[model samples]
Target: MKLQKVLSALVTVLMVALLVVATSASTSAQEPKQNDGEDQTNLDTQLYLIVATNQSVADEKLPAALDSVVKQLRATLPFKNYRLAATLLNRVKNEGRLDLSWIGAPIISAQSEVSPLTPSFSSFKIRVVKLAKNTAGETVVQMAGFNFGARFPIQTMSVASANAVPVINYENTGLQTDISIREGEPVIVGTLNVGPSGDAIILVVSAKRTSR
Candidate 1:
């Protein structure tokens, strides 16, 4: 009888050991999966910036206006990428997922303080003129901006007769032989046929200087 009782106790202990081992194995398997899930969640939480601008401006006006600012951040900051979206002010305010943004004037003034980053611009200029203003009264064929760093000019041409010119005005020559104006470092020359309004131009220069 004593031997039988001993055998029963041994059996119980073995069963308990087996149960403990099974539970430990299950826990170990579940832990790795749970850890992986958490790692993925962290990756999803990684920050990305969303840049938004107003749609009221013609689409053509936007790329140049904002690209300089975006490029600054891309050069300096640590972010995956920036995405441009045209969204209403209220919609932007309500989104919990917006990590960073480059918004228009209205949104910038309103929500910039609360955002993770503040938007700023690089020195740039925009000139618009009628195509008839060029020397020799020829139709303005292209607009040029001189980037001093590159020591070359960025020239763009428009078809609707109205040329949008952005010049990097290093020389400060005003409305010379070429129908162009000075930005900061590069001079912008305008071309094309739309200059009848006598060359209405807008120049936007920023306070920040890019490092060499």
Candidate 2:
């Protein structure tokens, strides 16, 4: 009976020691577990879709935050105007996958009074996402199999024929590539030429930790 009690006490002490070690490891901020459970870290990402067009327009100021991006675009791309298309936010755990499908909403045509425009489809997907700190002390988000695709209506031609309507065709375009973005900094993923027109779509993305 005495031997059994000694063994039990020793086991209890070992278990306590192990638990203390675990507690210390978890609470050590220097050894961060960014890929841990949702309760431990924030893995939400925000993406901005901007349309770059050759068509000039008034009030063409993009968000001041994207000023650097715009300057770079102007130096490289031939687009004369930029417009904000959409802003999307999605949450993903580390090394997890996410896909979001878009349902295009129908809107009445400004040119044609007879029918509403056809609905288009758009989607974004990522096969795997990871988060880590870079050598520059910035949190970096790395995404693999990043894909953005869409189909939209485009007017083929305008005619003055009596009792005739303009021809519209659906065009499919997208961009697929891997991307790495630093926290709070917008990174341009890629661009897709929208249609026969000189317009293009630019995809900008950023990520942040909502640990607060």
Candidate 3:
């Protein structure tokens, strides 16, 4: 009888041990998995627009902060003379807006529009379509549905006349590109011809990871 009681006690202990083990396994399964040195957090990207011009404009015409960028571009780009026409700083998310405006010589005009486009002011409306990381671990951003507008002078340019103010408008829905930028690192995504007189606009983008 004593031996039988001892065996019963042993069985109870074994059952309790099994129950504890099962509970531990279940709890672990319900817990979130740990990230082993992988970055699972979403990143916030910042975009900086650097508009370089071959012709120098008054310092008062540009934002005060752009003076440094202009100095850097003068040393880097092949242009003998370049000035920072405009600087646009923006942040990135699922969907955002980028509005840019600058006063300079008009470089691009619609073919259907009259010649000698005299618009000296330009503006852009850009939409951020998507932001995702690619398989190669590069953060890619896609932008579309962008439009560029130029204010024309009162006069119009034609084959007979060389002077005219003609407002030019263009839509670029297919303006999309992939950019890989680390925190505080700037990369030039692309360039736009701002003037027929050899002036160009350079777009520099940068990003940094933010806490959720």
Candidate 4:
């Protein structure tokens, strides 16, 4: 009887070990496997909008209608005769939806002899409403609105006040209408005026499409 009991205990141990292994194998099979090219197929494309302001200074006093508020800028600004004002980026899809992003705080430098005049409100927000290929086979981007505060310096005082809120509609085409931007590419659309005087706050815009 003692020998029979020992043999039964050994059989139970072997059964338990086999059951554990089967359970582990089942779990492994249920786990999902990743495809080698999955990352490439699921890559996303992004769009970026770069905005820079150019201020033109005249030696004589600016006209009353011409609102002038100048601020010194870093010598390392990208474009000549323009300051690195603001930059914004957005991810675009073909879903026909609008995208909005806030621009960084205005970089207002103190007045200097070199660049003493600048715009009051240096920063604003932009809305990209639509993107499509037109009949001309051009990639056109429709801007829903450009919301910004119109600031004018208080006469004889250093303080500035918000005068008006303006929303403007704009449209532009791709750099090369013949070439489609499947990968990363940049195109300069156009320029806009932010100040009361013409060209006071010149907004230089460039659109870029990139894939990740």
Which has the greatest lDDT?
2
Task: List model 1 lDDT by residue over 17-69, tens digit each.
Answer: 99999999998888755444331111011111133223223222334444665
Better structure of 2 and 3 per TM-score: 2
Task: Please rank every candidate by TM-score, starting with the best.
Answer: 2, 3, 4, 1
State in Å the error of residue 10, model 4: 46
- Give one digit per residue, the lDDT tens place, for model 2 in 1-212: 99999999999999999999989887895675675545345578877778777654542577887888888888999877777767789888777787998865421122233244567678999888888777888778888899988877777887778867778787788888987888778888898776665677888887776665
Could you tell me every candidate's TM-score relative to the true structure? Answer: 0.21, 0.70, 0.42, 0.34
Task: Determine the backbone clash count of candidate 4.
Answer: 5
For model 4, residues 9-103, the per-residue Cα lDDT tens digits are 99999999999999999999999987875323221222322233344532333222112211212233332244334444445443223334332
Better of 1 and 4 by lDDT: 4
Residue 191, candidate 1: Cα error in Å is 20
Give candidate 4 regions above 4 Å deviation.
1-80, 95-128, 146-155, 158-199
Question: Best-fitting candidate, measured by TM-score?
Answer: 2
- Of the pair 2 and 4, which is ahead by TM-score? 2
lDDT score of residue 212 within candidate 4:
50
| Local error of candidate 3 at residue 9 (angstroms) | 1.9
